[model samples]
Target: MLDYRLFKQIDDCFASGHADKARRLLMEVQSRSIALRDEMNMLHIRLKTLEDALQLARNLFNRDGFYWLKTGDVTQGPFCPRCYEDEGALIRLERTGSKLHCPYCHASFIGSARAAGGGAHHAHILPFV
Candidate 1:
């Protein structure tokens, strides 16, 4: 079976802006899971789910306090990145005129700081593969 601890670690890495590290860790877990004689199928499924979440993170357009999923050549959201990183949520903000609203936390904002992501401080994630 897939351990909840792995998911927690993945969440930690993502919350700290370590998508690459989370992906590496997921790969390592997947490799180790190959040796398990039972519960292998279920574990594989869970690993795949975790990987998908991180992949979503990678594709996110980091905005001021949220992230947008740029998919199909169109930007999909002004989602709360904090919610996504914390709980793997894709909480979409409701657009009202020039302001966007997050129902989860009830925050209001306009525009994006998407370009701000490039200069974010890197986390010191341990090497894993």
Candidate 2:
């Protein structure tokens, strides 16, 4: 299958409108399915999903800072990046009143769009040089 560099090459090929080459590279990965572990096989499937999402450029970090996945005409979100990347898990964030919380790590925030620095409008301290 393709490694990170080859995947990047595929990205470059697609960027240059070389669909044939990109598809070919994707096929190489699919063709090597038998040699890949179950996790790898699953990852390839997920990668394909991500590839389409990226192509659409619809996957975005919502106002609350959680990654939202767009599906067709609908958008789903509040995904925790910490869980997704670290544990290979797609854990959704919980909206509790004014805060979006990640249950996995207990990390909570009001998000940049909503917070605007979360009440720190004036500086009481300066850099001591």
Candidate 3:
């Protein structure tokens, strides 16, 4: 916080021909300004991180023991539940045989089977709750 009294003291020092004292006071003001700027920047970063987490929480949904991210009309992911629940990470699960595998946490989940006509297997998409 900037103290108005410091400015008065600095002015008085300069008027009394105390150049060194005035210079030292100016340096103190500069240091305070820099520290204030750093604190503000850190607060901005924290606020942005919190906003991102809130957005993700708003879009994230769970179904059949799996997590999914739904955005607008486009839904993406069948993220690993264990990784998300334990570590707060949305690790996308890779399909392998009859399971979905997490490359990051090495966890697995049972996925839907392929269609009879060899079409792609589709998981049931649900709305975010």
Candidate 4:
């Protein structure tokens, strides 16, 4: 989910009557939100596969099994731990500085992955045969 601060900023910008600024920020937020949702869906599928594999391991070996990490129904990262990649979840403009942080993992990057390139930070694909 995109942070509430993003919506607030959009509101603030529009409230200030800067149409161009508000439009640009809103567009950026929308783009980031879409990318985050896609990544989250992929993570869900990947974690499900991992869970299935662990179940099989438990059945076959009849021993202690390694399990995937998850916080509630979601896996435990907004940034890919393997790559330290990040997606924007919240926008903050405090007195210190402006920065973006992921609400899930609390990882902060220089900028949104999409703005840096054209897609999310790293595309992780699991190989199946």
Candidate 5:
């Protein structure tokens, strides 16, 4: 967690054996190191909190992980975060390209290379028929 750039600078000074400047830089490095350590501890606490929330979400959704089955006329869920957005929309839709439209709401679901996840890439359309 040390600011690696500053750590490197201090290391270079130490390696050069410039005792006076090295001493000063060493103090700076040590101070930054302590500050970085405290920051890391804070992040650790945050990570623990998120893990707890994710676990609780799994339990509430009756699922074992980040994914969960969405219920309704759709009958499928446990979708990844991106897919969940479409699930939230009034109508589920996917656009294969600039030309395609939502089968349900007739909304344009333009395709984009930026939509990169395998399962979450294209909105899988389920037939209402």
Candidate 6:
């Protein structure tokens, strides 16, 4: 978003034998260029963040009361539903006995019996706490 008029002003300064003014204008141009570069880098970072959010939205699903992330043929999580619903975060649940716990929100869920057996119902929940 640099103004092209600055370059013309620099050219006019040089034509009018205002060498000091031309040098100052050149420095201004350099400063503007650096600012533009930094702004572009920030925009790229924002774009990457938005893309990652889109991908997560496309892949995330709910089974029973818990959240799961699926990519390709692989399924990834038994995330905390309360955390995801309230904060848009994919906080992984920690299993203990027949219960799953969310460390972030201190929420607990009743995990499936098949969870201990490494079955497909791993971390699948029946109720919330």
Model 1 misplacement above 4 A: 1-38, 110-129
Model 5 stretches astray by more than 4 angstroms: 1-17, 61-129
Worst 10 residues of 6 by lDDT: 113-122
Task: Please identify which of the two predictions, 4 or 5, would achieve the higher lDDT against the true structure.
Answer: 5
Indicate which candidate wins on TM-score: 3
lDDT of 2 by residue, 1-129 (tens): 436677898899999999999999888877665556776879999999999767645455433344566666666655676666577556777877755677776666554322322332211111224
10 residues in a row with least lDDT, candidate 4: 60-69
lDDT of predicted model 4: 0.47
Expressed as tens digits, the lDDT of each residue in 44-107 for candidate 4 is 9999999986854443210011112343454322232322223312222111133334334433
Candidate 2 accuracy as TM-score:
0.38
Which is superior by TM-score, 3 or 4?
Answer: 3
The best-first sequence of candidates by lDDT reads 6, 3, 1, 2, 5, 4
- Candidate 1 lowest-lDDT run of ten: 120-129
RMSD (CA, Å), candidate 4 to true, equals: 24.2
Q: Residue 51 in model 5: shift from native, Å?
A: 0.6
lDDT agreement of model 6 with the native: 0.80
Candidate 4 lands at a TM-score of: 0.42
TM value for model 6: 0.79
Taking all chains together, the TM-score of candidate 1 against the true structure is 0.48
Per residue, candidate 1 scores C-alpha lDDT tens digits across 1-129 of 557688789889999999999998898778667756456777889999999878886787665555778776677766765567777788987766756666785556555333333433222212223
- Model 5: which residue pairs collide? 68-78, 69-78, 70-77, 95-109
What does candidate 5 score on TM? 0.38
Task: Choose 5 or 6, whichever is better by lDDT.
Answer: 6
What TM-score number comes out for model 3? 0.81
Per-residue lDDT, model 4, residue 96, is 13
Clashing pairs in model 6, backbone N/Cα/C closer than 3 A: none
